[model samples]
Target: MILSGTYGELRSNHFHSGLDIKTQQREGLPVYASADGHVSRINVQHYGYGKALYLLHPNGYTTVYAHLQNFAGEIQKHVKETQYKQETFEIELFPEAALLPVKKGELIGYSGNTGSSGGPHLHFEIRDSSQRPMNPMLFGMDVPDKKTPIVSSVFAYPLGADAHINQSQKLTKLRLIKQMDGTYKTEDVISYGKIGIGVSAYDQLDGAYNKNGVYSINTALNNTPKFEVKFDKFSFSETRYLNRYTDYGYYKTNRSKIQKLFRESNNPLSIITNEDDNGFIHVQDSLDYSYTISVKDYKGNDQTVIIPIKGTKSEILNPRAIEETEDFIYSDHATSLTKGKFSVYIPANSIYEDIYLNIKADGDTLIFHEDVVPIHKNITISADISNYLEEDKDKLFLGRLNYKGKPYYTKTSRKGNKLIAYVRLFGDYAVVSDTVEPVIKPMNFSEGKWISSQKELKIKITDELSGISSYRATINGKFILMEYNYKNDVLTYDFGDAINTETENNLKLIVIDNVGNSATFEAKFFRK
Candidate 1:
């Protein structure tokens, strides 16, 4: 199978967690089960792993198939029946082991660009007995490769306030030089105290040209192993640790993944093992250390980088000083700030370390610092909107203001005068109202037309301000299932299951945006 992604690849706020198999940029190719197993779990959603299936094999392993355009004949039948019974398009189902069984290489579903997929590909995964994702390449999946991993960038980081790199208290980017023997060497650095290293690199296979995740990274000093990291297996619960695993602040502005070699106090990623100094290197007063960094892919191809560090006596200069403000919020404990009609709560452990937050209130907007720092969990923002007009209260909700003065909708709950919004991203917050309704237009069938020969009904729904919250479709005053594709904002309904007759039918659709703004569509069609 052709691959587009690698397991445990560093993604935004999480690991890739699976391998993406290329489907030729199209859907509807038959997907087969990997081994003899029973249908254990199936989940269908508008985002994430859309139309995903899980199979539990007797060998204490589970396989997953995701981003399918449609399931096989039997699987599709069962899913439709369940959707109609529940009156909802997005649903999760689990059949008893005896009911749905499959042998090795049996057809299960068809590949599609469903869920949060950027293109048409199948995201396949294999888990161990504990349901933790394991590298499928380890299970004899042959991936032909001869190219070595590419080292794009390398960095030297001063770990603490006492440390200095290149005679300055800052992070320094090292220059890498490629040698004739196909190896990388970074310029020698004069550093003192505790220091860490980071690298930005990727791997590529033989046939596919896409930059995939490196399988393993090993760092050594003076012929002794210092740290080792592998992308073999990991737990889903620890996936969010990816933010701490990488240089989050650098990635926010640069959009490049820089994996830190040293583990932070809060980064509890399981992929790192066999660490000597926890991936940190200490330098003596007058000495130089030789370092080696090796990156490899599953195909046994590898690349190496030689880094030399010279110890120099230097003092930390111009360290970041915590600013004092009227509303300074510390991250160690629960911190709250209140001013005007705005209040915020930063829960304990939501932040990785002690951070000074810049908060203020101007007019009706509450500024909770810019989006520069990384937050581990969500902080609640509350505003008193009792002054708003009673008639417009339903339209008013807590919104995160963007640079263009537009509001990004969040699920806001109100109790009396307090409107609360729990957000993970740090930004300006305010009470914004959205009164414009959504727009719905038919795609496949038209008004007053015969759709007797059509297989499905499709409608496109869109909202300019607040995003779509919920949508429902009804036929003859009864609820009918309408599958929503959030990527394109299109809702589809199969005529075979819901409209299986040659008669006149009345259809009604109701679509609502985030802040109570809604629109309705009704039409009549002759189906034979």
Candidate 2:
């Protein structure tokens, strides 16, 4: 099977925990159990791994199948009963071992595009008893990958304030030349002091054109191992450390991830092993060094790059640029800022290093630096709304500025006269008022229409402002389970549920926005 995303691939905010298997660009593909196991947990939600199932195998491994369309056989029946009993579509259930045991290769579910999925695919993973995800390729789930990894770009960074590369204290992009025998080489580099390297590369398996993540990356200085990182396994708790491991500053400007060959002081990713000086090369005067980088795929196909370095200690032509302001945040200490009606609280260790920030407040807007730096933890921002009337307080929320300079609704909480929001990125924020309610329209069967041959009923629900918060539907005063697909803004109810018994039925739906504005839709239809 071809893979759209590989295990341990670089993603926004975290590393991909599983392999995304391509489903031929469509849905409804039969998914079978990987091994003899019992259903341990079942979760149905609108976000994340929607409609996911966890199976505990006899070998102390748990296999996860996510983004499913529906469960098969008894599993489907059990889930439906639990939903009806709980009166909620989003529910988590754990079945006992004797209740839902299955043999290997048994049909478990059908694959579909659900929960935060970009398209139709299956997100499959294998985790140990401790819940750490391991590469499925190590467990004999093989994809045909004979092609070597392609190194698209290479860069050298002046690690310290005194270090310089190519006579500049900024990161320099090296020109790579393809040599014979399927290898690469870079021009001679001149520098002195500690410096690091980074590379952007991808792997392409046979029969698939998608560029997937490489399996391993290694670097050596003077024939000694400097840094080694393998995508074998990693824990979920340490996944967000990906930002600190890679060149996050470059990613924000270039829109590409460059895997750094060195480790930062606060980066504690278990997948990496650093040698002397944490993978930083200490170039000294009157010395010559040979640096090598090797990129490999899971199938042993590899590509190598060699660079010749000359140690020449010279005067600093271009020094590091520093932006300092009156406000400074120590990485190890908590700091709070208050200006007018806005306030911000940053916890200790929220940043990897101590840095200066340009923070200010203008009326109702708060400018909290830019998005160049990566934050390790969340910081809280609160805006006082005591000046607003009591009637408008419940309809107000905080919005963060997007890339397009437009403010979008953020999850907010209220404490008396304060509207608080916790965020990771530093950007412009302001308080916004949303009084508009959600809009609901019938999709399949309209008012006073007969839907005798329709297999399901659908309605389109949308919110133009603060977004939909909650929704509930009932048929003749009885709750009916309606699956909501937020991607398409469609709410669907299967006729198979048998909720509509009489020839004529009345349907009522109530949708509420995040600002407490509610809208209701009512319609009458003949189903029999």
- The sequence of per-residue lDDT tens digits that candidate 1 reaches over residues 54-117 is 9999998999999999888688889888888888888999899997898999999999988999
Residue pairs in clash, model 1: none
Could you estimate the TM-score for every candidate?
0.96, 0.98
lDDT for each of the candidates? 0.87, 0.91
Could you give candidate 2's per-residue lDDT for residues 360-478 as a string of tens digits?
A: 98888898898888988999999999999999999999898787767788899999999999999888898889988899999888889999999999999999878888899999998
Per-prediction tally of clashes: 0, 0
RMSD of each: 1.8, 1.2
Misplaced by over 4 Å in model 1 are: 315-330, 498-500
Q: In candidate 1, what residue range of length 10 has the lowest lDDT sum?
A: 315-324
Query: Per-residue error at 511 for model 1, in Å?
Result: 1.2
How many Å off is the CA of 321 in candidate 1?
Answer: 6.3
